[model samples]
Target chain A: MEKKVILDGNAVAASVKESLKERINLLAQEGITPCLATILVGDDPSSETYVRMKGNACEKLGIISKRIHLPKETTTEELLETITELNEDEKVHGILLQHPVPEQIDERKAFETIAIEKDVDGVTSLGYGQTAFGFGVYPSCTPAAILEIMDFYNIDASGKHAVVVGRSPILGKPVSALLLNRNATVTTCHSYTSNLEQFVKQADIVVAAVGKPNFIQGEWIKEGAVVLDAGYNKGNIGDADYESCAEKASAITPVPGGVGPVTISMLLKHTVISAESYMSKKSATL
Target chain B: MEKKVILDGNAVAASVKESLKERINLLAQEGITPCLATILVGDDPSSETYVRMKGNACEKLGIISKRIHLPKETTTEELLETITELNEDEKVHGILLQHPVPEQIDERKAFETIAIEKDVDGVTSLGYGQTAFGFGVYPSCTPAAILEIMDFYNIDASGKHAVVVGRSPILGKPVSALLLNRNATVTTCHSYTSNLEQFVKQADIVVAAVGKPNFIQGEWIKEGAVVLDAGYNKGNIGDADYESCAEKASAITPVPGGVGPVTISMLLKHTVISAESYMSKKSATL
Candidate 1:
């Protein structure tokens, strides 16, 4: 077989950000800055790193990043109050609540408190619904990123058999919804799925979002299948056995630079979009 | 081969209605009658019959049925206004806008106008999201009916490979979400799906919602698989060629009395549930 194509996330991310620079400059002319407020309620090192990286990305793109680090013991009510404040704040174009808050916090309730307009991370139930219905302004970023990579690489999803492993609400479920909306015949598989390999072997496209390292093996991949791995495990490994699967896949995204970079870029893009929406509404009213 | 089991809809629907009677009486004691307000736009004979059937079902259960009939030329704005009125009405426990409004009406916008509290038919984008997340109050009736039948028959969805043929917002999509929530590995296929038979043959549970009579052929069925046909086509035929499929299937729902009766029962059940919710809130406030 000929050399397999590596789906480059950095290239996709760079292109995405490059396209946004012009839009960001337009907002700058209107004296408005695209702002994203990210709330981190715990001190998990990984979550902290993710937040900082997002914040840095925002700064790089001429957007404002407002980081709110709440103590681990914060109550759900307090979290709701903070979200309400951001919802009312005219300058905050986007709001993101980092996942895995303290055990006591009602996480879903807190996510619900974020106004739909500012839910840039797409954690809200309403946001998820809108995305599933196909008119959502901002889908959950990771799912959006998966599509961005596909679109960048010119991978057509329409009329294809795409098997998605894992069904996490943000990553797996939303991405499945996105692919389905694009007219792919989507099979959503999880740990409870029986005979998983049988389904994977028949796919035109395989999406690995199961989170476990090397969960999807080489033999599971069909010849010339397009593989998009959305997993980021310890030691930077993805859900699929990369070296082996790449041998069979016609196109595959590597772990470190595959989906993660594009995900942050999507968040930034959503913030800019939200800011533009606000500016347009402001202009209309003026 | 031993005879296949016929999944009887009348038996399941009767049981559901029988269970609701006591709850309905409790609401009556509280001086609250469960009410469903249905908005029917235009004079499509099929839609008219459906609305009337739902109204009749509500009356049979001692629930109030408020039917609003509008002309073919009704604009989206007029439909939205009617929905808003129902949303604000304290006595209306549920609101259902019959599908396939006239060409000029913005059907989705009108569906969105019904308040979340009154979206018993599960038409709104918000409701679809809630259903996907597994916390929806009322799922679209047909999807709910499909699950009700599965539960009624004690067929477990967990770990099963379910193939859903159709992607309609109200039927195929919601049912796929519902089955996924129940831990079934779900493949959502539509007309765009390639080699539809191969997917169907792999299913442990097959849901036919494609709206075309005999679309799912008998040869596509796996031996001993459970089939739930949600299609109601002309001449009282189902999506599945029932006679042929039944021979190869372990259990299947018949068209005329199958999913159809249970669907209306689910609507009635949802209206009563909404009324019960209303009563509890009123009591708590008191």
Candidate 2:
């Protein structure tokens, strides 16, 4: 028997934005406008386009968007100072720094500049540790979104073996930590990992985030395993070879339409949550 | 075919302490007094003994040991304030709070209070994250000691499967993360883990840290797996059945002789390192 299903990224993201309208309205009534500050440096055409899309999404959701654009020649100190200013801004509820800044600037410093409270993108190790240790805090948006999608699909992770390829601080590492928090035994594989196929074959759930175009072969996948390919490579190529893997996998998320849309939606949701947390604190004090 | 080699914890610790004295002398010539602060609450005889032993170790190594004794009635707020003060004090380099504080106090709060820079014990998430992410920072004493022991034995961990039993934040969690950083494929098992025997059976290296007596059975170990037991339970029992496993394993650390002495040695080493870092910073500014 053959099965067919279509995934729509934009429509799913739009639905999430619509769902948050009421919460945004409630906070607006309380005079607390949730604000997100996006810092973009050295306009890579792709980064510029992505930031613009996010800014547009924020507008549709009634979240105040504060856009900061720095030139390519901006020094690391200058970028850090700007981020520090945003961190101190009580009006700002969330901070997002569009990644892949100029090679000269320290990207990690820029990401860490977003205070733990305002780290809507949740790029800081502080944010990661909180989630990894099972403390109550925001997770990195993409990882949280991946979990949200899994939960939405009713995938049970309890006692499952999860193999996460790539251990980038943002997505793969935190996601593996999250899966561990949910009682799934997790193994993180990187370039140093020995026998990648052996580890991948043992996974009940496979999250491929290596960004190498179709690096995960279909033969390595265990039949009926859940596959999440978060890699958005050239021409929308994913980390997994979808054609062969999809045939054997019980459930799988397609590249462009799968994790990408959920990630954006999660970022929007974080802005609203940050605003609510700010409001709750204000009310508690009052 | 019999080896008559037995290790002594205190003597091994003394040897490490003596080796560190040269570094301590170099720092001293630069006007650095390596300081280690030991905070003990209540009068648990065992804790008192341990703290005193640390202080003595520091003294022998030309390090300054500051012992802070708080009453059992100390509030969590009081303890937190004390730790915060130590964190800010330029003179104080490393902070070690004796664990298992009074029942009324929050242990997590106590751990979190230690400044990331001053947390030589590596109990805080900041320390754990830095260690996991491969940053140059102090790891929890026991785990660091385990590494030191392994290195001393000249064991190559590259491409090896290292299975770590137990998932305590201090010893087990940090050790697995450390092993992973060393290019060992790591599997972290805890109370909730199922088929743990299977994971243990497949390891090139096995670390038993569950703190339960003989939690690891001898037959499950691969014939030539390197065994590192960090368990210190009642009656000098380790998680692994030492006699049975030792005969089968290529290299094994006996219960009392294995990891215990190295742990104390590493703690003192961190104290000296913390002090040296502070001293250099002060000298640079001066």
Candidate 3:
């Protein structure tokens, strides 16, 4: 049996952190601190923990983090007001609204309120569009981090057939666009996709972003394909059946340590870029 | 002998125009004339003819068309100013910048200047992004027209394998997003794509947007597939090997009468939608 390669999300994320340090220092020296504000509506314990982990990551990386909690009953108008305030805040470089905002709130409408320059988490439609159109962009964090990991591993996507198994706006769709932009022949599959296994078998690169745990059967992945599992369900379950898929994959990401850590790292990375871009534009105008 | 089905772009466009007659009248009664502004940068005769044809279409549909000609030496700054002026104009419901602006001008920069609301031709990055994210959006005209044609033909995309050849931001990219939104398993291919024929043979629907004449071979198209030829090269040449592909295809769009006229019709449709939307927003505010 050939030895399979494991792509370490922690190691890759640490390296990205090292690269961002100098830029973070430069901003601090110029009396500009890159600030990211995260808004969480409703008290979902897991959402809170996720927000705290992100805040801790921000603290370690020297990026300022402001966490705001809203009541579960918060209305869309109130949330939009909060986003608008953050959009206008000169000190804030990025705005992230923790997803699954209480069922009452219109998450899309709230996302649209974030100014494009400050959409470091890349939740806004404009961010998605600009990235789709191949503009210099702050990409959605998880998908962008996947690209970063691939680049670090020297995985050139050009001419490769990449099959993305999900259509979540943040993960599957954006990842497909990024891959297509990099010259990968991309196939976007979802629940409605017939013969999902057939599509997976044909891909040189397979990105399993379908949220359902172990949804992608491991055997469907051909030998020597690069597998990226973006699903991190409760209890370490991922989109791909990791053990089975890894046997066939030349390289595959582990469930817990694969996509999560790198995703957090990209959030900070985009925030720093946003800070620099915004401050430069302000200075240029002055 | 099986009869081949040719999708008539002209008759469809006329039907679309006819359907809008009531809305056009309602807008007229409200004194809200839906207007489209066309910005031309240089004396490109082909471009002039296209603009004139679109203008004539608007005249037939009761939509106002403003054609603004700028000298070849028009600076990006000057064009931006013109776009800004149009963005603020109460009367201009849509703005279309005929593509391929002079070499000296930055076309993307000029496109970003169009307000998202008035981007009926959907050239703005924001417009593209909004459409990709499944928002109520004014989509890029040509791709939207293709969707309209498909809808008119009752060609449901659900569970279909759609191969989009070409990655041009305008046609191939946007159309891929639209198809995905309709639940089609979409494969986006381009010049860098290898095994193009293999992919095409597996597709239920094939969209040829590659600029090269007869770029997609006829035999690659599977029997009973729907073909959309978006390529309109000079001398009436299109991307697909039309005769051969049509023989195998259940339905196919012809070069001159297939995708072109419907594209113009969609521009007017989007404009009317934008005009009505803007007026409603205005009324809601009042």
Top DockQ prediction, candidate number? 3
From the highest DockQ down, the ranking of the candidates is 3, 1, 2
My TM-score estimates for the predictions, one after another, are 0.99, 0.93, 0.98
Q: How much is A268 displaced in model 2, in angstroms?
A: 1.8
What is the Å distance of residue B270 in model 3 from its true position? 1.4
Per-residue alpha-carbon lDDT of model 3 for A213-237, expressed as tens digits? 9988888999999999999987999
Give me candidate 2's TM-score against the actual structure.
Answer: 0.93
Model 1 residue A163 distance off true place after TM-score fit, in angstroms: 0.7
Model 2, B1-286: lDDT tens digits are 3442333445557677888898888887887788888999999988898899888877877778889999999999999999988998887889999987899999888898888889998888767776776773898988998888777767777779898887777887788778888888777777777788888898889999998998888888998888888998888889899888876688888888788888988988888888777877777998
DockQ of each: 0.90, 0.56, 0.92
Comparison by lDDT, 2 against 3, better one:
3
Clashing pairs in 1: none
Error of 1 at B269 (Å): 0.5
Native A-B contacts reproduced, model 1: 0.92
User: Which structure among the candidates has the greatest TM-score?
Assistant: 1
Top model number, lDDT: 1
i-RMSD per candidate, Å = 0.7, 1.5, 0.6
What lDDT does candidate 2 reach at residue A222? 89
Candidate 3 lDDT, tens digit per residue, B162-232? 99998887899899999999999999999899989999999999999989998888899999999999999
Q: Give Cα distance to truth, residue B222, candidate 2, Å.
A: 1.7
Write out the backbone clash pairs for model 2. none
